[model samples]
Target chain A: MAEATTRERILGAADRLFGSHGFRGTSLRALTREAGVNLAAVHYHFGSKHELLVATLSRHIDAINAARIAQLDALEAAHPNGDIPPLDLLNALVRPAFAFRHASPENAEVVQRLSALLHSEPLEIVHPLMEGLFSRVMQRFAAALERALPDLEPEEVYLRIQITIGAMVSALAGRHPPDLADAPGLDEEERIDHLVHFLAAGFSAKPLNGADS
Target chain B: MAEATTRERILGAADRLFGSHGFRGTSLRALTREAGVNLAAVHYHFGSKHELLVATLSRHIDAINAARIAQLDALEAAHPNGDIPPLDLLNALVRPAFAFRHASPENAEVVQRLSALLHSEPLEIVHPLMEGLFSRVMQRFAAALERALPDLEPEEVYLRIQITIGAMVSALAGRHPPDLADAPGLDEEERIDHLVHFLAAGFSAKPLNGADS
Candidate 1:
């Protein structure tokens, strides 16, 4: 087995701890011990626990954003002239993250749980990092969605985008909230397809007021 | 001025600390100090920090659920025979919460943020309490949704219910994700109306496969 390096060890341990215990719940001392590193090594390497968090999140953000951008690029190439269907555009937003089915289940769970927290929580330390990572990517998708739905006011489009992200983040969090009925189990691909279809209809919904008409 | 009772004080302090710093981040010692009570008082009133969290959440849950049930009952009466429109059903889920607009903004913000976290984040100490509080309410809404959309499978109804909730929780959390275009501002009423329309369309969306058709 290839030995993990100190930085990699720290990041892995931090990610798991943060994902499970949350940012403030996981202390630096506990993180150091979990990483099998000296306390001083933590500060020497990452400056502080907050910096370590930003660093850990940055690593995943790079991977997720890269995958999303790559998906968008491929879709654009195939469609040409940006005549993308709205559902196809929504799929690009979610497909990369849902691609975790190919990864080890344990690793995928931790990443998704962590991704859900980072997106949903209001911690100051985490927000700027998440925004920085996602802003450009969100803009690209927004433009694509606008082209696909020319009738949607920019504001309406924005609300639907936010709602779409909310649903995606909730699914990634993996709680499977207690249901009144037997919740159907969709395999990973079907789950993604269901989410894409649901969100496409939501995005295509007409405004409440007659302003647009 | 009415002096706060020991129980009320403890609940208030815990709510703020938990809302601002999260459940794991807030400690018993800090909570006691902030509440202007001693260590013994915390245990005297709430047993432990975990119990304290349950209590704090319960206070809000009681109010919010009461409001929801009341709204649901009123809608059912007006539409009789469960012929309620899906948007009105969706409204019952959100209208009560959005009524916070008439209250103090700070109080509303904290409660909404807390609600979002409790629903989204998984913690052993927190889940059962939340589930106990919400399960019956969810079942009622699910039944109402089923009646409104007879074509939707029970499983599809359940999934859309989850998605509608995801959207509401995300909005309450209020991160205002970075966007390509300037997001429009809507008053509380307008926001709730927008959400109802968007989610109603989502719930009414056709299933992607022939299984449902």
Candidate 2:
């Protein structure tokens, strides 16, 4: 229990530091100090700065993925008629992320930092960090999808889902932004609701004029 | 003529430096030196590093947006009867970037660097740099999209398009670990073809379960 708390403290520091300074800019010493822990404690908990990042991301990201997968699976089971309901599925897929992102309503800063780290171009260091975690979550949804739309090629479903994810990611990850100044109607709750609804429709619908085609 | 050339040269230098190093990481001295010009030339051209980012992104990003608009216009004009085929549209959107990204095939580093900058998380100095340029471009596309999908609500279309862009941006920006390894056929040409088809179908489709209900 105490170890878990130490892990949390280290993550809190890492998230703040990583977000404030890009990955390269943050240091282990700073993270330890911020966490109010010693070097020995950090090393004991996470080994190296690299290990710390993996652990930090894994701590929350894993749970978020689980939530996404579980929500998706539940949605499918609830609507098990071979006909998928897109909105519910999409919402289930995305909610965990946005919720995790804005967990502390009072402080959106940490989320923003995470957003920056996320939006920046892919890097070698972080790829493996998230690959095993997100890909599995992604694949579970893909499998459920395959069961639903058996006719569709895996590639087709994959691409379609990926595009949907891309859009949702950007919408939620607006850390460096136009300040949401123009987006008037969608409050936080509304944003989630709208995003879920929009994505569901977009994914649920057959291709444009698909019914006719 | 000389002034314009000098301005372009400065932008080129800034793009290379900023793309590789990021906003906080890059320095004006390096920029001026790379431009092979003195501090006066740098100031005369952009006034500051902040403005330099604005100008460089504006210069390149504008070209990209213009290419996208032109390409889309051409394709839609060619295909008046049916839905503006999604794959074709996806191509129109992504090819310019693909070409620009790979234009200097020998210097993969250039592409790597620029990609990093665009996906960048939160650099206080850089966020405002490209705002004016981004908003102007976004408004243009928004207006164009309004014309293309008049049947959809303005907000719905915007939200959908944002999602599509997010996926496309993520893939192109390569900000995170993508499923390309599993997506075996995603060679340069094949990737473009797939994205176009996938996104075209995506944007063209109706909302799942139909929001009207």
The numbered model that scores best in TM-score is 1
Local accuracy of candidate 2 as per-residue lDDT tens digits, B1-213: 235477777777776776666555567788778877776787776776656765665666677778888887787678675456445555676678777766754333333344245444345645565465455545555555656666666665566556666666655655344563467633555555555555565566554333453
Pull out the clashing pairs in model 1: none
lDDT per residue for candidate 1 within B145-164, as digits (tens), equals 88988887776777778777
Query: How accurately is candidate 1 docked according to DockQ?
Result: 0.46
The structural similarity of chain B in model 1 to the true chain B, as TM-score, is 0.84
Retained true contacts (fraction), each candidate:
0.36, 0.29
- List the DockQ of the predictions in order: 0.46, 0.29
CA lDDT for candidate 1: 0.72
Best-matching candidate per DockQ: 1
**Model 2 interface CAPRI class:** acceptable
What residue runs in model 1 are displaced by over 4 Å at the alpha carbon?
A2-4, A15-30, A113-126, A182-185, A210-213, B16-30, B115-126, B179-181, B210-213
TM-score of chain B of each: 0.84, 0.71
